[model samples]
Target: MSPNLAWRPIRFTPQLERTYVQCMTPRIILLQRLACIIGIASFVGYQFWDLLLDPEALPRTAPIRLAIIAMFAVVLVITFVPSLRTPRYLMIQYIVVYTLLGIGWSLILAKLPNGFLAGVSGFLLGMIFIPVLVNGAMQAAVILTPLVLGPLLVMTLAGATRLEIVNAFSWIVGGAGFAVGFAYLLDVINRHAFQLEQLLEAEKTRSEKLLLNVLPAEIAERLKAGEEPLADHCGSVTVLFADLVGFTELSRKLRANDLVNLLNDLFSRFDNLVEQHRAEKIKTIGDAYMAAAGLSGNKRDHVAAIADLALDMRMAFVEFCQDHHLELKLRIGVHSGEVVAGVIGRQKFAYDLWGDTVNVASRMESGGLPDEIQISAETKELLPARYRVVPRGEIEIKGHLQRMTYFLQGGV
Candidate 1:
């Protein structure tokens, strides 16, 4: 997962090493079982060779073969031990047991009649099969070199001809070289696949985060689940709209980048407040921010949450203005009613609301006084008695007759 754990020629980070071991452990266990079964069968079957080639050698080798079979049985049983089943521990066990098995085979070969020829053939097969049992080139070499040279050394001490030694050396080294090359290729391919998988996982995480930022969590999941025309009739929701007072004139005076920076700073604070109060920020239009509560789950206190969010937004905007040395005001409007909320657009998707409640909330912001939070009668009725409100009665709302409104002052 981290760059530091990327594959290297000789050494690997602990994370990569653990991952490799985890991936290979089951395969290794299977191969170990197969090896044990084959080794037992061949050792039992080879008693005929002892009878035909050298009757004198039978008594000497029979017990040794039985002992080796017992050892193979022990190794096979170790694989099933629950305590030793971790990846690293199992790998270590495999290496140790396999190396010992190679040694045992070498000793058995040395005991047979015309043992030099038999040892040469046996060691050649081992060198060829080493890569499949082990993972990396270095690991293959570790098992291979000792098995190859150890038997040759034993044969030399047993007074083998120089020609026999030379022939065995040539064949064993050639096979080991080929096996090591194949092991290296396998390592490279495995590492590439691992890196690709990590990249894909990271990309999926980023896409999900971006989607969550664009839409509410519930809506995003619905879209992901192939729910088309995603819409809901919210019977009770409190919507809040806040617009920066005189931002149009301020934008005219400031540079484009400065204007954007100012809006970003101010709205970023509003975003934090929305999160703190458990409200879903619908979207921002220029200097105006829209958010709603009770759009997702059962939040019976949605009105109170939106009211607290609006008050916090007013305070946060005041602090932002002081920090930036500007005289600015925020006009926030609150209204509670039914609305149709859904995801709109196929390309640049938007989660928005459509209903008379949304229109009335917007009109509350547009028609309200600067530096104040305005609320429709529906919202005012839901507020706790702790909050202070004064009637702004009979305001002329756009596309509607005069309606009762109130200015939300502050908590008593």
Candidate 2:
């Protein structure tokens, strides 16, 4: 029994997608086959009529005439119908076209008097053309050569067949053969074209999903199409960095997947916080996360954005600790300065900022006390008095000669 119905409610399956494709493929193939059959029937019908009435011939008696029409009809049915598109139908078409051609043309040629050799030649030459498949140019050559040259070649060479109309119908066989072959060829081209297009659409869908995974939709599009910021932009933005203090110990206590899930959960919440303040997240390095604001097209007010986010994170982490009973703390640092920012990379591209301002922002986080928010003096200059600023005293930040730092405790 199929498991699809049993598990259908739990997950989606490829079977549904396949069902739609299945209905379409055969319907189209059938249509093309039908058109090929109809075209062949019309060409052969006109030829049979014209040939039977030719004045210079032993007239078509019922048996011979009936045989010729019957043979042609069978060939047309088998060759051009969708039912015959399969291998079984192909065998039937080949048997009919060749057998009828041999019997009918031989009879007509035998009566041509001096036409014997030309008829033989036409039969042999036609065999060479109708069977071999090549480009459309070859098909045209096959049909037209017989029409214009049948009498010329046979009569001019062997001096036979005074009936110009008989010669014309002889050549019309070439046209009929070419028409059938050409129609078949066109359908082949159409099917291949559709397959190519389907592959491209699949690729486009996969690419969209990947882009969504890497960056937010709006940002990814601007970066994808090579759009650039209007000017060499500058921004006063808040940068925030968060790192787990002893994740190595946490890793030792949990499975690899557990640690990964924990990190994913933690960072996802952090991302939500960044969004809540309309900030842009930069990147995450394992247990570390970096985010910034004002560079997301904001030329100013980064300090305020970072400040507000820093307070929210501290409160959220406190609540998380209480609920999960997991001891947790975050060191958040905020700095505001003009940073040179732009996008980078071709594959897995990212937008980033460089310059002393962004560097100072990272240092503030590292220099911060766990459970506290740290801000550089430059950041303090712009912040409102709703937050109490505690001077951490002048200290040497790593890789810096000297710097002043302060703690932004909540409002007094």
Question: Which candidate achieves the best TM-score against the true structure?
Answer: 1
Cα lDDT tens digits, model 2, 1-412, are 2654332222214673354334344653454345345434543553453355554454533344456656655654554555656543443454445455445555555454444444444543434433232223343343334444443444344444456435545554555565556544553454445556767989999998777556655677776687865223565666777776666676788888877887777777877888888787878877778888877564366667777777887887777667656766788877887777666776556666687877888888887788878888888998877778899978678778778889887754
* Clash count in backbone of candidate 2: 3
lDDT of 1 at 272: 88
Residue 54 miss distance in model 2 (angstroms): 33
Instruction: Please give the lDDT score at residue 104 for candidate 2.
Output: 56
lDDT of candidates 1 onward, in order: 0.81, 0.61
RMSD of each: 4.6, 13.4
Candidate 2: the clashing residue pairs are: 146-171, 237-302, 238-302
Best by lDDT: 1
* lDDT for residue 408 in candidate 1, whole number 0-100: 91
Model 2 misplaced stretches (Cα beyond 4 Å): 1-213, 216-219, 227-233
